[model samples]
Each structure stands twice: as C-alpha cells, then as structure tokens.
Target: MNPSNQSPNHTAEDESQAVVTRRIQRLSLHLMAISAQNYDLCIVSCSSRGKLEVDKAQLSRYMRGKHREIQERVFEYFNSRPDLQTPVEILKDDHRELCWRQLLGLVREAGIKPFKYVAEDPAQYFAIAEAVGSVDMSLGIKMGVQYSLWGGSVINLGTKKHRDKYYDGIDNLDYPGCFAMTELHHGSNVQGLQTVATFDPIKDEFIINTPNDGAIKWWIGNAAVHGKFATVFAKLMLPTHDSKGYSDMGVHAFIVPIRDMKTHQTLPGIEIHDCGHKVGLNGVDNGALRFCSVRIPRDNLLNRFGDVSRDGKYTSSLPTINKRFAATLGELVGGRVGLAYSSVGVLKIAATIAIRYSLLRQQFGPPRKPEVSILDYQSQQHKLMPMLASTYAFHFATANLVEKYSEMKKTHDEQLVGDVHALSAGLKSYVTSYTAKSLSVCREACGGHGYAAVNRFGSLRNDHDIFQTFEGDNTVLLQQVAGDLLKQYKEKFQGGPLTVTWNYLRESMNAYLSQPNPVTARWEGEEHLRDPKFQLDAFRYRTSRLLQSVAVRLRKHSKTLGSFGAWNRCLNHLLTLAESHIESVILAKFIEAVQNCPDPSSRAALKLVCDLYALNRIWNDIGTYRNVDYVAPNKAKAIHKLTEYLSFQVRNIAGELIDAFDLPDYVTRAPIARQSDAYAYYTQIVGF
Candidate 1:
C-alpha cells in the first residue's frame, strides 16, 4: 500500500509475498496437526479419479430445474424492463429518495409480493425474494422490509379480520410497509425497547408514544419516502384490575399507519426524517420515526397470540407468558431464515465475479513462460475456492432450512420452531460472516480493477458489509444459537435424549466417550478424503468434543459468576460451539446433496466442491484436529495438504463450478468477467 510500492513490478512483489505468507502460516499449523508422535493421516493424494473434465453440460443444469428456471424467469423479467433497470442504475446516482421510490414501484410491478407468495408457495415466494438480493441487496431489502417484515406480521400474527384488511393490498404491493422494531437505543435487545403502547379506556384505543429521543424508531426502510404503514413492536401498557397503568405482558406488534397513502407525507403525530446517506443499500431510503401519543383502533394489535378487549383487558390463549412471547417471535423467524438463505444467492454472485476475474487476470509465471492466471497460484486458489465451496455448502443448508420453515408453518410445532430458530440463527451468522469476508476477498482478488465501480465488486463489498449487522447482528445471532444448543446439551445431561439430526451430537458424544483412549490413528491417505463418512466422523467428533468442553467451562464459570455473567464470560467459547455445529451442518448437508443426486456427472463435480469445502475448513482451523486425540495431529497436516490438492482439483473445474451458479452477464455485471472483452469494456467505461 506504500505510494512508492504502487508500480506494476510491485504487483508481482505483493503476489510473491502472499504466496510465501501462506506457506509460513501453514507450516506453523503443520506442527499443530502433528502431535508429539508426528502422526499423519494422508492416503494416496487425489488418486481416486484420473483427470476428469468437470461435467460442464451437467453443471449447466446443476442449479437448474424448476426452481432455478423460476428464478431465471423472474430475473429475466424484472431485469429486462427499461424502468426497472433505471432504479438499479440510479442506485449509484444521486437522489436516493427517487431510487427507493423507483424500487418500490418496480417491486410491485415485478410481482415480488412476499405476502402473496407466502400463502400459496412460501418457498418459491422466499426464493423470488432471495433472487432479488442476488441482483441488488438494496431493492431486495426494500421489498423484503415491506412484504416479509410488515405484511408477514399481519399474516402470522393477525386473525382473519386483520388479514382481510391488509393481505390483498400487501400481496400486490399496493401498500409499502415497514417493520418498526429497532429503536435508537435498542436493536438486538427487543425487550429493552422504550416505546410504549398504552391502552386508553376512554376511546377504546391504544396510544403509541415515543417518550424520549431513544425510543424513536431508527433505520426503518420505506419510512423515509414510501411506506404508508408499519408493524410496530412496542411494550403494551395494559392497566391492571387495580387501575395501575400497564402490566408486564411484554413486547407486541401493532399495525400503525405512519404516512398518508395519497400524499406520502408523515401523519400528524408521526415525526419522520431520512437517516441521510449510509455506507450501502443507498436505495433503501432508511429513516427514523418518533411517535407522540398516536392512537389506533384496539384491534390494530396483531392479536393472534395476544389481544385486548373493549374493556381494555389483556388476554391470550398461550398457556404461559413465555409461550405467548415465543409464539409471537415465531412469526418473525422467516426474516432470519430469508436473510440466511438469501445470503447464499449473494455469495454466489460474489464468488462468480471473483473467480471469473481471477481466471481472466494473469500474473507472473515461470521465467520465459507466459503469465499464469492468478487462480493457478495456490495462494489465489486458497483465497477464492474455499469461499466458492462455502457458497455451495450454504446453498444446500439453506435450501433444507427453507423446507423446514415451510413445514413449521404448516404444523406450528414449537419444537420445530425452537430448532429452526437455532439453526437459522447460526447459519445466518456464519454464512453472512463468510459472505462479508468473501466480498472483501473477491474485491482484493481482482486487485486494482476490483475497486472499480463498473466491475460491481466495489458496490457488492459496500452493500454486503451491512448484511452482517442487520436481520440480526452476527454476534447476537450466534450467541442465541449457542444458548439454544447449550440448553439441548443440558437436557441431555439431565438424562433426556438429545435430538439433533444427521449431524448427531448425542451419537457423537457416545462415540467420543467410548474411545476416550486413542487408537493408532492411521489415516489411509487421499482415498479416505473422498469418503463422506470419514469427513463427517472428523467433523462430528470435533463438534461433540467442543460442546462437552464448553459445557464443562460454563459449569466451572457458574461457581464464580451469576447465570448471565457466567454466560457472558463464555460467549466466545459458545461461539466456537455454534461455529463447529454450523460447519458440521454445512458439510453434512453438502454430502447429502451429492449422495442424493441422480445425475452422475453433476454429482462428480459437486463431490469435488464438497471435499474442498470440508478439507479447506479443516485446514484453516487445523487446531480442531488438536485438543482431542480422536484424530491424529498429523491428520491435520494431511488435511492441509489434501485441501491444497483439492484446490487444484476444484481449480480444474472452477469455471464450470461457477457457471453452475447460472449468473448471466447481467447478473454478474462485472466487466473483467467478460473475458475477451475486458480490455475494451474497461477502456470505454474507465476512459483509459
């Protein structure tokens, strides 16, 4: 980054350092993977199959079929129209308000109505919503805030009366709505909100009041210029029988109109203003709002779980206060799951751009030889191929999550709700964290041209940065997942059977306990690397051991700290547990996807991506192979070598692998990725 280091020769200098740095770093890990005995677990390296050309024809149909077909149609339709293209183009231009309005109008026109699709085919509906993120997170988020957040509240929490009033219009995007939840002082801590909705007996209405500056709704999409209403989350101030104002009935959702539909103006008591320019999602028109004793009909409460009567009496069918709160929250998991799943699509776009650019961008090679594609370097492959592998991993994991969510909607099972919440929270945090890193890596992978706006990596890097914080902050979501996981672990300790699927924690615990003493851990080499069962054994064993260690740590911490304090102290360890579980889930789900694949060619290609994912993760966290002797330390070194070997294997098919994402030029929108046209494209655009 030194100014004097900004010459063409410096590029090769930096690339050399990067390659050497990776070697030094891995050599350090190599020792960690080798125990005092230097035990190693690498068989024949990548000898399972001879150089098989990646099945490009099958890969073209890799992510195809009905859902992809559906996505393509929607993408083509929404992307084709002149007006719709204008909003995306205007995203980088001035007049942020105009861009958001254009987005809202086009969301309606494109029939990206989340509420409409949720009632019929929810997965497809969610898919279309996610497909939007692949193109532009700004527009996707605007559309999602309206239908998924605002209208989703009505569908999930409201009875027939509320649905009849809002569902039809919400479906067609006739009304733009926002989910008013986070306050200036409260975001992840929904329970700490200061906004109060007091029951007024005189008018039989609820008075929504923002008592202080901190209580003002902040970062609300659609409120700046477009939304007419919001599904507001606030404390319910219900009077007790003793006439005391408010009970501890907790936070609830209420339908509050913020703007006059025709005028698009803030209502009398609703103070609204734009949040001004932000780092990304510029077209979202984010704004803040403060309510001053705004009154709405008592029925405005989305009262499927809790309600107030004409006499201002609070009521609910949920057996316990906890049940009522959980049920209400159950209605909102879709947002988390949607974001988690949607991240996969976004990651795909990023991976496509980075990989394509790497393949096209060449650098120093052997003396007197032609320059090599950057991807041909082990250092460059290390940067992008793993991210590509994770994109595939998340793709299957999130797909399964979407189906589980649909089942939860149908059955309304509390058990499923709890599990889904945990899974989605973990996946959302892990995937987005991975994605944020991927965008930056992708941007850097392209070197200088990556910073160019026309290549799309710059906007993508900026836009994806916020995705880590929203939906739910990554750290908070991971903590929640960790907490949920620990609860299950505790239940198992109390003699209750553990109930996790595929990546079975209980069975893993039993296996680890039975083999407390290490056997001569002989890794049969590269052939064993191709065994999904062998990979799962390593992953599952690590997760089980980490969970056990974390449990012990928490128990020990409890002796000195209060429950919350003990938990707070163990947050980092808990995150480790959550991450371990997530990595296992990603691996298990990917293996399953390939095993269940009917197409031999596609399966063969996906198998390489899957192996790369597993090996790459194990290599990076080589210490996972340490601590417990279930796997030998040298096996970790083997994993590192195998990952490098798998990287080469994946590199052979990198184009087809990315091509499987099916991102057309319009979707990728990166000039460098245009291969033969890169020079002409950047020349004309950059006026070089």
Candidate 2:
C-alpha cells in the first residue's frame, strides 16, 4: 500500500527514513551496551580511611598562587552567567559566534578590562585569561587575540599617539583585531617573512603588500569573522636617501585596517579567507589574510622600538636589526606566559577528572570482597598521581614566571626582560607539550569513559595539541633556551655576574666537575631521597653537565661541520639541556613554595607531592644519573621504590589534591568530575 501511494520523491524519502530508523535502532542498542557504568554500589562499598588532613581551601589558594583573588573573581563571574556557556553540540560557525558573544558578555557584564591590566598589572591579566581558559579555551584565546595580542601590541610596541588612537577601541572590542605575525611560509622565522611595507614619502603612507601566496598571513585568530584590524608584521622598506630605491629595514609591525567597522565588510585590497574546520578549538574563527598594496597612514607604524619618518627615513633605538627584532618579540612574552598558565589549568582539569573517576569507578577485587577503587591499583596510581604532582609543580613554576615578568614590567630591567623571555619560552614549550601528551594519558587512565567527548579529554587533547607548535614551536623555543644558556655559560667563566637564574650555574658546574661523593651517591635513606637540597643538587648537576657536554660537542663539531651543521648535529643535545634547565627551575620553585608554606599540614602534604615529582623525574631519566655515577644502583632502586611509595601516599590524598584545583562542575562540564554523587550525575547526564 505504501509503494502504490508513493510518488518518485516519496520512494527516496521513505528509503532515507528507513535507513535512519535502522541506524537509530543500532545506536540505541549500542548505547545500552556501553552506557556509563553506575557507581552507586562502588561508592557505598569504598572505605575512607586514608584521606589527608590538609586544609583543602588553603591548598587551593596555594595552588592558585599569585592573583588568586582575580582568578576567583573570574570564576564567580563566569559561573553566574549561564547564557555565556555554549552547548557541546553545535556547528563550527555557531560555536565561533557563541564564543564571540561570550567575549562581549564578559566585557559588558564581567567588567574584565584586560587592556587596563596588560600594562598596570600583567599578573592579573594572565590570571583572568587563565580563568577564562578553565571555562573554555576558545574564549580564552579569542580574548587573548583581542586584548593581549592586538591591544598589547598597541601599548607595548606603539608610541603614545598610537596607543591613544587604538587603545580604547581595542579594549572595548569596538575594533576586534588579529595579531598578524605568522605568514603562510614563515612561521618561526620572522626574519624571512616576505610581506613588505614600503613607505610612500610623497603621500606619507605605507603600502603593505603580500608579494605572493607564501607571504599571506596565516592562522590569524579573529581574522575570519570578527577582526576589523591587524597589527601586521612586515619587512619595512624605506625609500633610500639617494632616491634610488627602498632599503630593507628589517621586520616591523604596523596597524592595518582589514575590515570596515560599520559595514563589516572586507576592506579594499585586503583579502580575508576562512581557514575552515580544524581538529579542535573550532570556536575561534582562524583565518588567512592577504594584503595587496594596502595603504595606511605613516603614523600607523608601531614606533616604540623602530619608526619611519614622513620623509621615509628609518630610525630605531636598538643598535641593530637583530636587536630590534628581539625587543619586538620580548614585548610579547605575555602570550607564552598566558599559554603556560592555561596549559596548567587544562592539565588540572584533566588530572582532576581522571583521578576523581578513578576513585569512583571500581574494578577487580579478591573473592568475597568489595571491588577496589581503580586508583587503589598501582598501574592507575602510577599514571594519575605523577601527573597530579606535575600539575602542582608547573603551577608554582608558572606563578614564578608571572612574578618575574611583572617585576620586569615594573623595573624595566633589560636583564629581566631577557630572563623572562627565555623562561617563558622554555616553560611554555615544556608545560604545553607535557599537558598535550598527558591529556591522552589521563584519557586512557579513565578507560573508555574518558573516550567520550562529554568527558572533554578528546577536545582538550586536540585543542591543546597546538600549544607545542604555536606561540613558538617547542623545538625552536628550546633551541633559544640552549642558545641563551651557552651565552650565560661563556659569561660565567669570563668573570661576569650571573643573573638570578644562572647564578647557580657556576656552583653547579663546579660541583659536577669536582667529583661524585661516594657517601652522597650511595645514600638510599627515605629522608635523603626526599631532601629538597639533595633533589635540587641532583637537578643542578644534570643541567650543568648537559650544558658543558653540549657546549663541548658544539665546539668540537663546528671545526669540521661548520656552525649551522654543528648546531644541527647537536640539536637533540641542546633540547635535552633546555629541558633539564627548565625542570631544575621548576623543581627549585616547588621546593621554595613548600618551604614557605605557613600551614604545617599543607606543607607536609605538598612535600609528599614534591618528592613524588622530583623522584619521578629522576627515575624517568635514571640512565643520565647512572651514566655519571651520580647515583649508585642501590640509590637508583631506592629512588624508584620511593617514587612508588610516594604515589601510594599521593593516591590516598588524590581526591584532596584534585579538589584543591577547585574546578566547579560548570567549568569541568563532565558528569564524572562531580565532587559528590558522581554516579547519579553520570547516569542522569548520559540519560541511561
């Protein structure tokens, strides 16, 4: 009867409906088969004998580090505004629109004038961005592109006139913009960027041009939809004094209007292309841009470090083009600092979810007994506890970086700028890469439940994966760190005073060169392994030794391989040294934090976590310690045993440790991350 009544289109429509019906039936059975497991019986059966006695809120405050109040304020603001939250299931364009709306709501309602804090209080600025990141990374980055990259460029790189002209609009989101630095072909190598800005002396204008497809600006946040202008970096070409041609005056930034504000249309000679769908962070509209003789007033150039006159004369306070480039980049160190903080936040969320779920989801047990919490299992503890310790360690380290950067801003110390830049580069690279990898570890640790998108491991992993490449690629950043280390190493031997970070280098190098004391090397006591002094000394030795070894290798190879070839040969060694130095810096910061903790209970608990962090790192690289005979076989074994023992100790306090992160249900948006009643929450959200 259906066939007889069916029209030509009706037959196809029915066939389509039949296919959908069959697919839905199959999916319904699959959901039933793999529905989230209920934790009611497990929760009831679990014993609570091993909970830590630390003050949870105090630990949270300590973990939040500096600008705790600002972070909390942001959290409260976001929590109260349910309308700002985007649904999990939406198209990319919708997600981008919602993210933009959230940004507008934040400015209009939350009064988060990030531009104000960028200069007056960068720590607060970073804290606000980190908090936004905890809610949604896309919003965090969009805010960054608007306030930090664009507005920060105006404030940091531009003159007072440029600031007066652009600051208000940028701060209020009236002129949403892009940080158009990276080009399609020149991502890490700014010196090679082909985009040119030629000054027109007669008209007093700079004509920006994209020489070819390769010169097009790429991966620019906010460029596709919202950005009206960009702080475009291009090779400055000033008209020659001889009246012959233009002189290449190196890379400089200029404010170029990309879209008409009232019409919301692409401006003439400025092309904008959507980057289309990405692996994640689809909420931010990333796009490519091309400039074909885009003309702007001569005053549009950000003239803090460098400037061009109305007559096409180029001037810079920095002595050389290299110095100018360095200064320009140094002013933007906040990006790396913010990313490091956000990466840590993401890691905290992942660790909290995985650890909490591990405690709730019970698995194998002996006969005639209640099943054990998965966290009770050694394998799970090994996976989650160390990450928990690292989260704390990175938190303290990033806080230190923020402090150093803030101090640099206040003092305007050239040394501090270099130090902040190097540290930011290293920490951003190290922490983001670690968090990127650890997301998967956390995902796997939670078993199949973590695979579900609602749990956030998938999106978190995909979104944070770029942290290794963007801002600065990890490899290049590490190389920069190594290069700086070598410069310091040379200075140390030449009787130059070392910076605060490198002061220990001389002593550590001396200690490494002298000898490995038999008594220290063979010391296997728990107290000895846990000693902050001993842990720091071991870390210092590793870094100093690596520095010396890499330096020697580079020098030896340069004789035969040439400088660039030698560097290529020693790239792996340089990376190791960079990582070792960054780790040592992080470990020292964690130790200082623990020592300074006023609460005895919190301090003791933190010491346990610190020991785990240090020993776990040492154990992971036991071969390095063993190769130099810095630790005896027995000592290495003891370190390994203590690592396991500390994991067990941390496992007992796992819930508290994660609870200290203080991510509310709204921020986590995962049913299993609930502090209490995760089972009921999981079933309710999954609707099974």
Scored by lDDT, model 1 comes in at 0.79
lDDT tens per residue, model 2, 1-688: 5777777666777888999999999998765543333333333333333546878889887777667777777788878888777666779999999999889888878877788998999888988988888778898889999998989898999989988888889888899999999999999998999999999989999999999999999999999999999999999988775766778889999999998889999999998999999998899999999999889999999999988776666778888999999899989899999899889989988998998899999986654468889998778989989999999999999989999998999998988888999999999999999999899999999888898888889888987888889899999999999999999999999988777787798766897766799889999999889999999999989999999988999999999999999999999999999999999999999999999998888998999999999999999999999988999999999999889878888888888888888788778888778878887878877787
What candidate 2 gets wrong by more than 4 Å, as runs, is 1-52, 241-244
For model 1, the stretches where C-alpha displacement exceeds 4 angstroms are 1-50, 60-64, 86-112, 241-243, 514-517
Winning model by TM-score? 2
RMSD each, Å: 8.7, 13.1
Tens-digit lDDT track of model 1 for 1-688: 4667677666867878999999999988876565322322221234355555666656656554457756776678656764555232454335455556545555556554456677566688777877777667777787788777888888888999999888877866777788899999999888888899999888999999999999999999878877899889998888777766458678889999988888877888999988988888887878899999899999899999988899977788986767887788777888888888887888888888889888988887644557878887778988888888888889989988888888888887767777788888888899888888888888888898888778787777777788788878999998887777777777776776554552376556677555634543557388786688878777777777777888888889899897788888888888888888888888888999898877787888889889998877776776656655555776667777778888877877788888877778777777887746877886877567
Model 2 worst lDDT window (10 residues): 35-44
**Model 2 CA lDDT for position 391:** 94
